[model samples]
Target: MNCPKCRAGKLQGITLKTKQGAALGLDQCSICGGVWFDRGELEGYLSGAVEVLDSPSLHPKLAVELDHCEASCPRCAKPLAKSKAPQSPRIQGDACAACGGLWLDAGETGGIALAEKVNAAFDSWLAGLKPKA
Candidate 1:
């Protein structure tokens, strides 16, 4: 499937197991550092299906959300909302509050959800198990 954010490239196929042992889809970038998510997958990942387990030794890439920015959903061209990361509440992501979609910035794919530090550790290790680089 193509990225809903932009026609930049097609979404890669990736299924990563979270620390909680739930499998989440991983949509990596072709040129830029971003991860695309199907609306349903995003919510499920956040709702604790794929719980994160964080570790300080791991420097997972942080997701910088452009939700409040001008960037719109490539599919609907609707504005996205800034929602707190699943693992960490402090970190945020560009979520299409209208469409239930999410937009993660370049390199932010690996960052732990700021809501829970313990979950972040497991999330990071699980994030590293993707099919590609």
Candidate 2:
């Protein structure tokens, strides 16, 4: 599959292993460093604590800027719907409404995973401060 963002970038299939030894496979853009995750794959990786953003192979410097318009799903060949994450609106995400797949720009996985961790920690701390009944 060709990269939706880079247009010319080839989508390379790679397997990412979580800390728990769970393996998830996805496609990544060799040019723009974006990732294409099938439905539930991103959630599974994050839940299992997969550290991937720091990988140099996944993030390569590109000579051209990424283009978002007209991006389509490599799986179903349908247009991708762009939106910001509800938990972290600053980070943009793309999804295939047809296939339920998700697309994230380079470094977005780290941002999302970090946010999840921080939110979990905050919730735990807040719960600990609640008055005993």
Which numbered prediction scores highest in TM-score against the true structure?
Answer: 2
What is the Cα-based lDDT of residue 31 in candidate 1?
40
Local distance difference test scores for all models: 0.56, 0.74
Lowest lDDT 10-residue stretch of candidate 2: 55-64
Q: What TM-score, computed on C-alpha atoms, does each candidate reach?
A: 0.52, 0.77
Each model's backbone clash number: 22, 0
| Ten residues in sequence with the least summed lDDT for candidate 1 | 55-64
User: Clash pairs of candidate 2?
Assistant: none
lDDT of 2 by residue, 7-118 (tens): 8789898887888887778888877778898887866766675666542344234422443356889899999988764434755688888988888877777777777788
lDDT of 1 by residue, 35-118 (tens): 666667665555654544221221232222222235566446687666775644655567776666677765344454544456
TM-score of 1: 0.52
* TM-score attained by model 2: 0.77
